[model samples]
Target: MQISQQDVHQALERGEFVPHFQPIIRLRTGQLYGFEMLARWAHPELGLIFPGDFIEQAERDGWISELTYQLLRKGLKEIAPLPGEPTLSVNISPPQLHGTSFVDQVHEAAAEANFPLNRLILEITESALAEDIVSVSKTVQSLKIAGCRLALDDFGTGYSSLLHLQSLPFDELKVDRSFVSSMTQKHDSRQIVAAVVGLGQSLSLTTVAEGVETEEQAEILLWLGCELGQGWLYGKPVPAEQLDEMMKRRQPHASNAILNGMTGRQSATALEIPPMQRFAQLRAIYDGAPVGLAFLDREMRYLSINRRLAAINGSPMEEHLGRTVAEMIPEFFPTVRPLIERALAGEVVAGVELTKPTQNPKELRTILLSYEPAFDESGEVIGVSVVLLDITPIKRAEEAQRESEAHFRHMIELIPQIPWIIDPEGRALDVSQRWLELTGVNDDQWRGFAWLDSLHPDDRQPTIDAMHRSFQSGEPIDIYYRVRRSKDHPWQLLRSRGSARRDDNGEIMCWYGSLEIIGESDAGKK
Candidate 1:
């Protein structure tokens, strides 16, 4: 059914176009990261109307830009003074993004709402990139320059998603719900979601899964390394007033129930079941869990082991059963014995990282272990439940990163001048040791646009504007500024030059630059 253009315009005029907010959760910590504002039409006669009911009509009528601006302004204003001041994400259609004045309108709305531009995220659907890529890219760049983050919504649904990702500057990618909802039922869907999560991680983008409705879906998403999630399981989109109440009452661990496999509320229900049925349910959960799980007797012998734990031990389930730590893996038995004793004594032993000798002698594996005591009806500890997580890959990644940083530091220290690196967005990534020594600033002081604080007060804004322009244009930078040698000293003039470091695809990865001391009078000459 098609809606008349006049109806949408009339609704807009009556202030009926409002925003409903759905929370986006960070899966790693299960905390509220932000919210996505969805447009809703609170019609008097027709009851509440969704965006789908009128958005297409509004777009065809050439008033989608106006509708978007209204929604953006309302959403920002409602969320700006939120208790924690969480980030607000507002959607924009392709037409709006392609419009000549869209970026200006966004800035104006943000200003009117007294919202910080950096705390706002503008989301464009993947399908919107089907046409006018160049125009959309220009608008996106301008919005980023004004300090609003960009997110590609419903990312995997588009035909040219890879192309859009390559050409655009998206800080976040929201995986479409079609894949997330079917992941458990379809093997191929699971693979696709995993791949998208991996792709986002590689590109340094936050990956969010949308339309999650079940704990199972959320658990799978967490296992796939997706950073954030949105769906009914977290909460349905509600009006600003209800959302405010929800935010205030939301507990940090509320959304993490799936991460722990079940919540206390669910556990209470489980206790009401018949003993046989409860055991069956528990067995199913244990077998299906992604991490290693084992049940140990007071004597520290394995009574039951899940497939994951068996695989990690490089042994079959039968072999692990009735075997003590010393009998199975003698090399690390001394280290494991104390942890088992502690758990049996009703104390939780967690976050213990153990380097154990695997079946392959040449390779040592890193494993993280946690133990929880199981209690009887009398409240006496009967046994222990052990969770073992293989963290070899994570440890290896950390080691490799340290080595890479050390190598880069050595190379930078060799240079006599102060060097720095900034990402494509002009946020500082690293600075040379000479920079810290000369400015009398610590490493923390030089990270993420904080390097600007080291500059003389008068030269800061001009330098920032010049760098922003250079970043947008991919041009070489040559500027002179004054820097303080120390807190007690006067400012000294310095010249800095930088060039864009492009990838094989000719996209700017970062800006590499160095600073050299010039004559004190050089600042005046410039």
Candidate 2:
């Protein structure tokens, strides 16, 4: 539904409007990077509304400038408390740019919040500028001179061309999310990415691929020479609290996971960003390559590596290239040395999972690796192409799963009463056969769907609703409901206590609860 200007003004007056931030990554380094400020509205009545819904209406009603001002003002104030100065990209509407004093207002907002002008990236779309080149150019120049970086957002889908590129004084180009989103499935999309990267380089401007959704696409963009990227592949738009926590964490796992999700279904090509002349030639031939290739000098210093190789190494090409293995990462020497030595000895090493430590403790304590020798034309060993795969998170996840299982069993065994774990849907994940034996129910009747059938029909709805509320609100829950042994038996009280598991963003991922027979204890007290 379209929101009226009065609604927009009222929401603004009531302080319902706010900015949501999405991260922008330095394609090479998987670090806690910059953010883009996206507008959001939390209407008292509408509940939650996206910027697309009301922003244009506000713009059309001559309140676009005020909205833009509010967004920038809010964005700067929120970022003021962050540990380090973070780059913030704020969207600029066409109307806001038309005013002669808009640039000055931007300066005023930055000064008001004591924010650094250099940290602000004013993102304007190509379509927005297409209609009035003269005014847009003036606005762009004004923003640039004020030390605010200008970015041409959504470059490919609109009126994008060499002329627009030449006329606009933008320091960055955000390749549209549409192209980045489809890069995995569409061959034409990949071609478009390659073209944009090439154009960005020739223009001497930083190219940021938006909507990078997969490890494969990130690898391809790096190979195609893109320097930066932003998307769900990197991270979804988050609130100030989440973004601050991410910065505090100083890692981008969630962001990277988002990026990986974008390209999960597409075939990934390994990037060859290494300077090695030989590896460069090999990269042209390897389509949808599975193996990671890298070239090291005599001292085992990395000279060049492909995107696959970099992913194997734990970063993007820009961050990995031009640095020695020891310089980029010294801990790898422990596991990497033996393999390098083997390659130097004219032997090909294979299938070995070498563990290398990362300087950052948050980065898995160690990295796993494998490698092969890069032989010269004379078949003489030169350098080793080290292939690193980060199995740390996976390994930790497995370990956590095992520990959870052990803990679950211990909790079940320790409790004298029948114990069971149930999910949000009130379906049992684990249940003790003791409860089944007490009720004379077969093991088959106690698992999964059958277990839910045991809940007394009169009490089931309330219990299920309580569990759903817990899952939705992320609140601790305890419910006492009745379970029937059979149609002939009286129902017994079952008390369940549970909590929700959420991701870093505070979204509920799953809910787990444990049930205990409370009837006996209540009877003893009575």
Candidate 3:
């Protein structure tokens, strides 16, 4: 029988939504790292409902947050009784990452369960990163402050995955199951897995391969320097009641005893090459970076610099070595020296803007400076690694945009008709001063659907219908409306025309329109 949405809602209240565990094993050591908790519906009439059947439905019905908290509570209660600090990973839906209560609720659940936050892992999918990234970032920071770990689930599936990896404080990068499962047969899949592992190694992140079902896959992942695996080969996701027995059955012998068919010491030694390869890749990335990269010694002399940085300094890369910043780029030196000094003092710095004059007298160049403290083996601050991004273009673009907007507003004041702009969804983006003056209101009051409030009551419905038709047809709309400056002023007939602002592809980017008074209203004649 197909279940109605109500059935799932009731199931949640009845506490039918529970967590199941899947083991994540350390590939190199063959030791159990943790258990990833998955949600299952323990329905009385139905045997068990997997997350696939109801996860999206819960999100759509606006209960994903509650469902997630329920799972966390149930899973924590079940896992608290287990031995050791084995991690418990739970998937966080996109909705749960937003709003105010998510972090507080999780803190409440963990506190009530008496589970250590360090061993709790919250897995987030790449898609979640796209929605309110600021919220996601704040959530990550808060969870980290609480000593909880975060995993980027299904890595490499999204376009901005790499950017997220750079920006967010993620503890784990999960290799998507599709790549892990296809590694043995598809060369591209295997390469992708290797690249992800290599990337994780470079970033010092624990890389986990999902859906590893065969020995060959594990072998390849281990060779690629990926140390964690999760899938059927380790064990299917099982109920918490069955966990203790499984743990006992799978406990490592002789402290993670060597797996069969491999010389343990040799296998461990062979894993060394990937790190060297990873370092080489990291170096290549550093050298070819779009921004300027350099290392400044304690004395503020250039220890190393990339070609891009050299180009920015108007000097050769090799020539930059052993020269003080003051000697190399006299103009840039004074501005950046203080930031480098801070890093040399063991303080990391970022986003310190440095502005200098370019060769052209009229132009100024701006670079965003970020510095990392380099440390020696003895734990002393050795030098500073500096990253300089020339953001002059972005700054210039922003300035030019501001000037353009000012110019547009000036032109709008000079025009006889009131001008307006709206997004494709009909949300008012901008309206001219004329409209605001005529309506005896501010533009803020007319944003979104509220713009209809300014129209004469009878004309509002007709205007909406006309806009709908125009949007649907992607055509110009010519319509009439009635409005007055105030209740004391007689209503006047106005002509409004709006047309789609199309791009090169003929896709509507927004709607631009103008309104003008054509005649006095019927009420004024009366």
- Top TM-score hit: 3
- Report lDDT (Cα) of residue 353, candidate 2: 59
Which window of ten consecutive residues has the lowest lDDT sum in model 3? Answer: 251-260
Candidate 2 vs 3: which has more lDDT: 3
Ranking by lDDT: 3, 1, 2
lDDT tens per residue, model 3, 137-217: 888888889899999999999869988989988999999999988777776787788899889987888999999888777
Q: Which ten residues in a row have the lowest lDDT in candidate 1?
A: 267-276
Expressed as tens digits, the lDDT of each residue in 1-526 for candidate 1 is: 5777677668879999889999988665567888999999898998888888778878887888888888888998898888777889888887888766888888888999999999999889977888888888888888989999999998777789999989988999988999998887776788789889888877878888999898778767775668788898888999987976898787764334443676645543543344456578889999999899999988889999999999988789999899887888787788889989999999999999988776789988999999999864224677999999999999989999999989988987887677878898879897777877778888788889888888888789999888888988889988888877665666778899999999999999998998887755434322
Each prediction's Cα RMSD?
Answer: 30.5, 26.8, 27.7
Q: Give me the displacement of residue 79 in model 1, in angstroms.
A: 0.2
Strongest candidate by lDDT: 3
Q: Native-vs-model 2 lDDT?
A: 0.72
Q: Model 1: clashing residue pairs?
A: none
**Cα lDDT tens digits for candidate 2, 218-303:** 77676566877887776789876687676765564332332544542221222223335535566675424665667777787767
User: Model-by-model lDDT, in order?
Assistant: 0.83, 0.72, 0.84
